[model samples]
Target: MQHFSLHTHTIGFDGQNTVEEMVKQAKKLRWSRIGIANHFIVHPDIKKATFYAYACKGNYQNIYSENFEEALFKFFPLFQEIKRIEQITQFPIYKGMEVDFFDTTQWKGDFYRIINLLKPDYLIGSVHFVDYKGHLLNTHDMKKASFMEQKEILKIYWKNVRSAIKFKAFDFMAHLDLPAKVGLGYGKEWEKEEEETIALLAACGGKAEVNTSALRQKDEAYPSNRILKLLAKYEIPVVLSDDAHSVSQMGQYFEKGTELMKNAGIKRSIYPIMIADHIRQRIYMDWHFMRVR
Candidate 1:
């Protein structure tokens, strides 16, 4: 029985429900607390991204930003409303962001600074976009890209996931095997990379999640059974998340998630205490004097 969820989105980003509506649903489930992790998609090249130009309907103008300071300012209203709701309902609501992990020194520097100032309760590291041949591609839009482009992007996508973990900018990883959604996750070419990622998480004392949303969208959960089994072998800390995008999605189908975890040999789940402390104590970035904590 999972008591909480930290992976959720609301109207401000790409979700259907309001914060108040989500909280109302949470009350019905009688959760201890929940985190509202809206998409924090501030990419320098997002304005130039060409994916889903015709395949998808989202304009994505308000959703992406190149300016970190402005983005932080824009998030203020959402956080304020969360605070108000917490006080009124006496329910614990943690401020969080489902960040799109970018593997650049500038991006990291800006991210670290903004997070320090925002002081969000938690952050989820995710790679929903991959830079492919000068154009940024959304992972979910994989079906729209050319076969050759998809092949190369899949390669880059896994590397980006690795970089995000090595960067240590967020609390835990999200949708570890997300590409499987588009029929590319369990490929022979990337199996070695998947093994390395699992080993990397264990070596770092890092945490991960069994995202229940995958079950809703597909036949299985994110971070699939094989990954979960390896996580158990490594004794890595795990959390179960609905990854809810609406009121109906909150704390739903956890029983199925638990069953998957059980089958995967994950005996227990953890409440992680550390954030951004990498696979190897600290990231060895380019700057010689810049010690990132």
Candidate 2:
């Protein structure tokens, strides 16, 4: 079967592989398309001096101090190279960012500006942090919060997702159940919130991704089988994303994810790309496009 993976990161972020090495691996896997959706730089306060010092501390430290513009400049050449390879190899490569979305009420401006400037072919919206008294509470920290507080944090995250969809800032919602993956320990309560969130996504004309990263964590894909069924009930399209941080992980666990989706009765999904504005308009209006298929 033909395969495509849209959520991958290379050395541009915390990923372990280079873009070329990733391409080679994807080719080995016979993937028809692979998108390099690295984490875009979000903070610019750290220069090379501070960045190296921060990296010395550990991966987690560097995660929060990413220099967005510097990362973009570093990755642009690799992106161009990937485009060149596509010309010869005909293996599709898409450019996009896995943007870290904090609460929209607080951090929306920066994300909005970056999206407008990049105009990426695809974008994945993810909530990696929650706000707490001017401090950034990551998912790791969020797990320690009280049950009520955890619910509030998830509610804010879902709210931010809704805003992202309303703004049309992303093509897919990445790792829809990221909070769950962190072992928030909310148990069944999260399901109710998920139901509401899935309904909201459907209303906003947005799609949710079934990220295979969770498979590596020894869990089923995010938005578990139950949530996937709820999404199907709401008619919210489901896309399978690997969230691959290495080339070998491209299209990884896709078979299992597709099987889960099939079991849930989800039959169709959408993949985003850069097309002419006229064509985009027609597609937006539900016009048939033989080429898109």
Candidate 3:
């Protein structure tokens, strides 16, 4: 049995614990591997987006900078600290970033440039906001309004998700049915959209995270049982993520999470290990391989 957590957060973003605290806690909990995947967003338009502003702190402009350079400038110190902690702890802490996917018209060029420059151990593609006309609307806010009225917005959300998959810039997809955060289902009419998204993910050599964080909100782990069944049908790979924001949350409820994966009919998980020359090759290995590293 392998013990590792691939998705986590620290004080650099919205998390409660610092990098050092997270690593030490994981060690105490006897975790073999962990990844610090803080938010690495550079959406300049968040300042005007009501939902985003409120969610990210309305008055704080420094959090989401206008360009990648400025955002990296503020983020570099935390990145360096994570590397330092990895050396000190000698833990298998991989560098990761939970990146937001935006449409090409919005900031495609910047997105490509940032990924090329940062080159994290892995990139977790997530869609929290959907492009409405020219404005970026938070998907979670859609629940605040009637589903009938937000039908078009929801459609566009899935559409953009397909586009994100086509971009093929990420290694894994996070919270596949994220719009469901609002408790709205895709219905039979949108089943095609769901299937297409899952197929694209499989075709792109992408994996989905069985995120347990949703349980904290009293919701099922993302991708729902229906979506997970589809993933299983398509033979798509899956991984476990705590999506932890604090020390106490690391691997929280993972026992139940593994049960969810088993019920979904998923068997193996992929772990990316870097070889000489720093190239990340997705190698399916057991716990002993990870421990000896």
Candidate 4:
């Protein structure tokens, strides 16, 4: 087993369990370490989003913020919880955020403020929303959409993911093919964006994770075997994450995730902070390091 998960969630966010409950499960499993990476999604127009998926009941718990400055205040307690947990146990538990990527100049400015203030132990960039014909579309809505509209969204989604990778702020990117589970990214129309994203990941020396959460729903992981092979071709290092929303899901199928990495020919799992070996420069501040290990 990998013995650690740098990407998992709990009740403070949209997850089903409390941080203490999740940590207790890890202790019982005797895991080497754990990372509490709840969602940190914010968008100036999120509340006014055209998509119905974003209006779900748990948006508040999931940390969905329409204003940047207000979101920072909300993050205070989540970070504080990490310190509180540390007092009760000596086991390693890192503080992290699975941030949704947005490319607007204003958004970037606010995002930089988050890094400067929150000071999370790590960040995982993700793309859960896409712009389609001037309307914001949630990838979770693809399952019900007509194929014609879905086709256009897939292109934007994959390119959105590339933009996130090129940004180079996260230790790793989450669920490269997030739409695959919803059944939208398998066509050849978006292959160029997908290929470009993989190439950009290799060039940027960014990291990706084999998210085991998808396997529990379908036979595939987030990147899928096809993309996993592509990541191997680029020699991008990988890590396993449960994307756990509950205690039982903490390490759900990590053994399988590791095997998938091995079969895909990925050779690195970020154990000693060796990301600088070939990741090149990421334009990050001295304090905000790239620690994929």
TM-scores for candidates 1 onward, in order:
0.88, 0.80, 0.88, 0.88
Q: Model 1: per-residue lDDT, tens digit, 218-249?
A: 66789888788887788777778898878898
The residue pairs that clash in candidate 1, if any, are none
What tens-digit string does per-residue lDDT give for candidate 3 at 127-231?
A: 878767666677666676565747887788788787778888777788888877777665777688899889888888667778888888854788788788887
> Residue 12 of model 2: what lDDT?
45
How displaced is residue 149 in candidate 1, in Å? Answer: 3.5
What's the C-alpha lDDT at position 192 in model 1?
Answer: 80
Prediction 4 TM-score vs. true:
0.88
Comparing 1 and 3 on TM-score, the stronger one: 3
> Candidate 4's residue-wise lDDT over 1-293, tens digit each?
57778788877568888778878889998887788888788887776675535446545434678776777876788788877987888766777889999888888888998778887778899998986666667767666678887877787787788889889998899999999878777766666777789999999988888999998988778888889988889878777889988888888987788788778777667642312334654322112222222
For model 4, the superposed segments whose C-alpha errors exceed 4 Å read: 50-62, 272-293
**After aligning candidate 4 to the native by TM-score, how far in Å is the CA of 229 from where it should be?**
0.3
